[model samples]
Target: MAKQTIQLQLSGMSCAGCAKSIEKALGGVQGVTTVNVNFANEVAAVEGDKLNSEQLVKAVKDAGYDASVIDHQQPEDDSRERAQQIQFYKFLAAAILSLPLLYTMVGHFSWTENIYVPAWLMNPWVQMALATPVQFIIGWQFYRGSYTALRGGAANMDVLVALGTSAAYFYSVYLAASLGDHAAHQGLYFETSAVLITLILLGKWFEARAKGRSSAAIKQLLNLQPKQAVRERQNGETETVDVAKLQVGDIIHIKPGQQIPADSTVVSGSSAVDESMLTGESVPVDKHEGDDLTGATLNKNGFLKAKVRKLGRDSALAQIVKVVEQAQNSKAPIQRLADRVSAIFVPVVLLIAVVTFLVWAFWLDAGNYGKALEAFVAVLVIACPCALGLATPTSIMAGSGRAAQMGVLFKQSDVLEIAHTITTVVLDKTGTITEGKPKLTDLEIDLKGVNGVTEAQLKQAVKATEQQSEHPLAQAVVQGIEVEALEQINDFNAHEGRGVSAKVTLSEQSHILRIGNIRLMREHDIESDAWSKRKDELEQQGKTAMLISWDNQAVGIIAVADTVRDNANAAISKLQQRGLKVVMLTGDNQRTATAIAKQVGIEYVFAEVLPEHKADKVKELQQQGERVAMVGDGINDAPALATAEVGIAMGTGTDVALETADIALMRADLNSIHDALFVSKKTVRNIRQNLFWAFAYNTLGIPVAAAGLLAPWLAGGAMALSSVSVVLNALRLQRLSLNHRD
Candidate 1:
């Protein structure tokens, strides 16, 4: 049999349970090989041998959901639709029964008090008539869930409540029908059972809504990519193609103010691209020929003619979608514990409800059958594991959302949990601690037979020679040369790792302007005895020296180096204040790394290390029992990122680095690192507080309800209040501001 692949666009999943339901439903289909559904992207990738899309749709429909094929692809299961239907029916039934039940219990109508025709024709029987069907119809999920848990040899809060409340309502109905009117009126608890079910359902609905909002963030992120691109045909005309249909090497014309539809390399033209959506960089970046551009970022000014380098699943936008999707799907450590407990919770609660009923009915001296039924109801109401069921997911959702708002994207909730414990941070030097681009910072001029070379002449000579080279020092030389009327050079040649040499016509003599380091000056035999003294002074001041020699004579010296980020020192200081040791790791020479580290307040520096050595360094730190966080922004830094306790990738870094990182700082600023750590600490604290309230509410509320100090109706109300309190507390994490204050 030949293996085949199918794709479908799905909808209606609101939680992990819904994803599991859809997976199971599709798995049950005959001839289906495998099914993988990503709830975050609402897409399903399916594989099978000779499978029919119609059959998949039918299978999902049988499981109580709607599904449809995408472009004749396999149909996907939509559990949210089914869940909504069930919820709507539950709310409708509860609403219809609650009105009559409440009126009979509290209203002073003459009919409510009538006790004439038959023993069953009383208030208790009327209440039973209104509530019993509602329990079976609207509250059936709790009963079925409880039964499933019991059979699986486990007990949850649902099992206890379902058994307890169901018994109370059924027994009351029996008493109302069998006993005389007075006994039936006193014994029936139809109002208590119905009210409990109604309130619990309301709580569930609210919880579902909250979860829906939190999970929607990934979907919203996906919507940022445009659906179509204007592809330039070979005939020089443009045609719009679906983004999914775009292939590599396709030339795409991006007009001014339009979003780049795919990650591509600019083949022609120039523009300023706004990458704020991807890197959170505040300023727009100038993109010319040979510059790479990412999809979903705005083209701010000028037009760009780009050749698509990556499309479909390979694009940067797609990678981001995958990262966020996986993060949401990955289970937090606390959630795994909750799952373990829930697996056994239902059966234990059932056993407790049974034991409570027997002890009250047969063991106690003053116990009546009616009172025993009330005890059972109290046990079930108090034991419901709804709070436990919601604890981990709610907190994870709130915490991750809060992190995203602060421009920190955690690839997993466990990262947030682990980040708070980090004791040391390993920072990559270039691009992370300092701006990767080199700039000219110092200049010294000395000349023979001339007073001294003017700054304009030095700049003109450097720019004329350096404009043809792509080296960092050459670019710095070009930028430092501020003259606009400098003559363009011809026959420009760059010697790799040395310098740039070009010929410029000056005063009828062909002059060769050479701009490079000392190595390049030596190769040309240009004497630099006096220039060497000035170069040493600049190097001590944390600058790199470049010699400018014209026609075998040294004219000027230009110093260039990577500038440190303005906020690096402050960020490092803040991290130290928070009790974290700041360490710098780099491939640069020890002198350069130490100079940069010292300026940035970093006391620990590991220099001249290769890319492969970074992970070993992290392991060495861990061997000393330090919980370390590695911050880097290069493809070479990926190994250390995976090895560290938490890997923080700078937003301007490569895709490999971002994907390997545990947390991605969307803004490449160092201050965002401080903000991220602060948010993580607060988030963990908030989660603990929420968990405490959830546990405390049950610990205190259960006994009071079981001891009969609180009425069943009041217990139901209190349960709703408890769930609300947890949600509100989790929401408070979003309000924290990380702005620095004096």
Candidate 2:
């Protein structure tokens, strides 16, 4: 049975340990095959054989987190924004309440003692009054989180905060209760707990703001979708309607500078359309009658009446957005180590905090209970699992989002991790390295001694016969045949890779017409004879030369060539510079394949290999220890694409090829190949840098805090900074650019 994937938005995840705890709970559910809970995005992607979304959500709630099913088609209702706003208000309240405690704190320190403190601020009643609300009210979230965590048989950052702050707050409350003792005011540590909460709230507020910018790419894409379109009615009138109301068969009118409403075909008029937002190609593409128009592309000039081919999720833009969203939610393989560490992060920190108090109070300091409490609080607040959790997902989100902006979409986080290791790049010749469209370039005719036949009649038979074949070269021949009338064809047959043949009646007589290579002519007991030399000459020029025959006699030869992309050479040069071996794969004959390969600076070529054998070649290279990345844009390329280590499909490719690919390049040229690989390498590097620092911050920090080197408030602030810094480093990927020559 195929697995079903479900996404859930989670709440109450204060740290990475919370994310891991929820993952374990969901995994215990029967039929759950895979679970990936992203701390940065606050989303859980679960794949199961027969999953119930409600059941999954219940499991999360049981693990101390709240969850609800996510809807892909609907726009987000901005619940995250509302949550951030609520946190901001809480932070403001905490800061305001903690200010008086901070003011009195200066009196405790010797260096700031000269600064006057209000005599009333030192009263025990005043100290308890200022710290109570900040402790129990503004900091209630930590208490609730701690209760839920312990009840669920797990621990998180909340447990530490609640434990440490409550110890200081309740201890100070005991000192305040003894109003008869005047020394109680000096013993009160209320400022420590209150000030710690204030710093933590400030840090969380900054971290939330940075995390918001990491997912900005998806928002930019969502904003690109036009909400409204001009629909043409049957009564010859145009009416503006919501894009959601459009259907597959609807007729839409596109005025100058208006966005195309849906994936449609232009039935009337011509214009230049800017598809830069989708393809990352800055130049405007010319669109004429019968050309396909993608939705969300700007029509630069002229009015067009188009018939919609696809709408909603079936459209190209929606699919691109879906790819990006799925990639951003995926977890990289390196995240497993982080998850394992986070599962026990809080418990380990809690143990260390207890050890610090024992060592400082009983062993080193002997009688100093106050100094031991400070060390214990510092140890509890300094160790952060949030940084480790945000490290990988934040980088993946930013990198994939930036890749999509450059017209490259990684289908999953695993692809982003693996694409940088590709050693061999196999490019399809016909449509990948060269423009998929082949225009008619040269056509020559020699009617031989076939008597009473005009060149036009023979050409008419050629056009009618070639029109039935879907081969690019055959189409080129058909378009080049400028005859006003076409001859009727009978018994037309297409030979895969060789050529096409048919029976045509011309000049009131029936004749056999064939168009193919010299081998096809020889198979039929006919030879190109005089045209053989010309065929070799055309093949030498990277053009496919076809031998046309009538009644077993050579009549003419037509040469069609596919132009190489303008940046093909530059892209190949860049790849070779990076130590990647570039190879060309094509069904075209050796001579033509070699010619095209030479033009693109590729030293290796797989010529005359049929479509079925494409996958075999990729496997053979893989067996030879080559990590292959197959790039193509046709139905024949799908098998090979799926066979390679990384399948890169051009956005202009067929649906089957694109769906089979791991990375989809929106641009129609090979320059995106360089861009995609560049982005992958840079993103992986960024992830590594983030992971290193996140680990180092915790590893080096916990010891210092336990040794009493950091103040409790400073420790709380540092913990928050660690997570924010990792996310900020990941956000730098959004600004990465390879400066493509194209």
Candidate 3:
């Protein structure tokens, strides 16, 4: 059975330990092949045979968390945002309630003896009353989460929290009940439990805010969709309607200063649309008849009546949002190490806490049970699995989201990891390096051998016959030479790799037209020696020359060329400067390929390659130990793209190219390639730094905490800050100097 990925939105996962339990629960389900729970983003992605969303959610519920299927079409769930608000209240309420107990605590310490403490405030009943709500009510989630984790045979950060705080709270209650009101000033630790929970909540609120900012890219993309559109009726009428009610194929009217309602093609009128939000290009693109108009692009001026091409989630904007969301939710390959440690994290901490309590009471500071209990609580409260869980995912989220805003969409997190490692960039010549649209540069006319036939007659015959072929070169000839269409075109035949032959009636006479290269002229038994030198001249100039035969006699030479993009030379130079070898792959002949290659500064060229053999060339490069990133934008480029280390596809490419590419560039230029590689290098480095810090905090803090060098409440503050620092480090990706203008 093939693996099917099922995505679920998760809640109630406090830290990395919670992720481990959810993974274990989901993996136990039948037919589940893999399960990854991203604690940072709160999404669980499971791959399996016949995976059921309801069943997966139930398993998570059984394991003591919440899960639901994620709906991409709808806006982001506001429940988590509401939860963040509630947590702020919890922290605020706990802090306000703990203030009295904290003041009473200052009375017990000799260093703060100068400070005044009221007898009523220091009463045992008053201290118990203040600490009770902070412990049981404000900190209720920790107990509930601990119960769930323990019932499911797992332990989480909540287990650590409940254990540490409960040890302090109940121990204080026992002392107060036995010692009566005298317990208030005699080593009571009610303030320890209340203040610890407040600090933990404070850390959670900050972490939630940082995680919220990390997903700003997705929210920005979703906000682009306009709510309303002006729909044109079939009776040549127009009315404003909700964009959701409009169907595909509906004609829409766009007014000046309004946004393009949805993805459509303009049928009439023209305008300058600012597509900076989608493609990251600051320039406003001009839209005329037959030009594609993407939804949410602002129309600066002019009126346009366009027919809708895609609606709802099928629109270009929606699809980009989906890609970004998926990228953010997916885990990076580097996170496996963190996951392995998280699986065993809480249990080991529990054992270490137990050892610290015994060793402190028996050996370190023998018979001092009160001091030993503090060491036990310190060890339990300080060990943070949350930082270990968030390290890689937070970096992946912020980095991938920022890249998407700059016109580079990383389809998966692993692709972001591997893209920076490409040593060679193999560029497909036609659409990748040069403009795919070909134009007629030269038309050599000669009717010397055939008398009574004007040059216009031969031109009409060639245009009418070429119009029947779908080849880019043939279409270029038809579009390049604008003329009235012929009424009759018959017996049109296309010869693969040679040219096209067709019989057309022109000037009240039926003529056999042969339009192709030297190979086609030979097959027709026509002599080609006359135009051999001219053909080489055109080919050397990076133009495709096709010879025309009129009634078996040589007529003229027609040359077509796809020009190199203006930024091609500069982009290639930058790629080489980044320590990548530049190679050009093309199906064009050797001389034409060489000429185009020289124009773009590419030293190595693979010319005269068939579409089927493109992947083979990529494999050959890989065999030579070169890690190649193939950049292409056609159906023929799919195989080679899939074979490369990373495949980059232009925005104007066919659907096949976009689907096969690892990174899809919204900007139809090579500069976006530089942007993609730059972001990749930056993102990978960010993940490494985050992982190192998260590991170091846990590794070094555990031993110090075990020695009782820190107090319980102080340890709780450090644990909370660890998760916050990791997320803050990841958000630095938003400050990238994309330099897309170059």
Number of the predicted model whose lDDT against the real structure is largest:
3
Alpha-carbon runs more than 4 Å astray in model 3: 1-6, 27-35, 46-52, 443-469, 481-530, 547-556, 653-657, 740-742
**Residue-pair clash count for candidate 2:** 0
Query: For residues 1-742, could you state the per-residue lDDT of candidate 2 as single tens digits?
Result: 8878898988888888777688889999889998888888888989888899889999998877789888756866588788788889988988888888788878777899899988788887787888889899989989988888788788888899889888888878776775434744446778889988888887777878888889888888777878899888889898999988888888999999898878899899999999887877788999899999988889998899999998777888878877887888888887778878888888899999999999999998987877889899988888867788899999999999998888888999989988999999999998788887787777888876887567988888888898898877778877877885464789999877678899887667777888888778989999667887888888999998888889898989888999998889988898998899999999888899999999989999998887889999999999999999999873668899999999998766214126788999888878888888888898899999998998899899999998889988888889888888999999999997647443
- Tell me each candidate's RMSD, in Å, in order: 8.1, 3.4, 3.3
List runs of model 1 lying over 4 Å from the truth.
Answer: 1-82, 107-125, 180-184, 253-258, 266-274, 281-289, 300-305, 362-367, 439-539, 543-560, 653-659, 734-742
Encode model 3's per-residue lDDT on 1-742: one tens digit a residue: 5668788888888988788789889999987998877788888888889988888989999888888887766656788888899999999999999888878777766899889989898777788899899999999999999998888888889999999999998988888899998887567788889999999999999999998887778777788789899998889888999988899899999999998889999999999988877777778989899999889989998999999998876778878877776677777788889888887888999999999999999999998777888999988988968888888888888888888778788988999988889999999988779888899998987888586567877787788888888877888999988766565668999886678988777666777889987777888799878888998999999998889888888889999999899999999999999899999998777899999999999999998787778899999999999999999883568899899989888774113126788888888889988998888888899989988988898888889988888888889999999999999999999888665435
Q: In what order do the candidates fall by lDDT, top score first?
A: 3, 2, 1
Q: Which candidate gets the maximum TM-score versus the true structure? A: 3
TM agreement with the true structure for every prediction: 0.73, 0.91, 0.92
lDDT of each: 0.70, 0.85, 0.86
lDDT of 1 by residue, 284-352 (tens): 989999998988889988988999898766777666655554454455676656555545554565566
- Backbone steric clashes in candidate 1, count: 9
Q: Between the candidate structures 2 and 3, which one is better when assessed by lDDT?
A: 3
TM-score of 3: 0.92
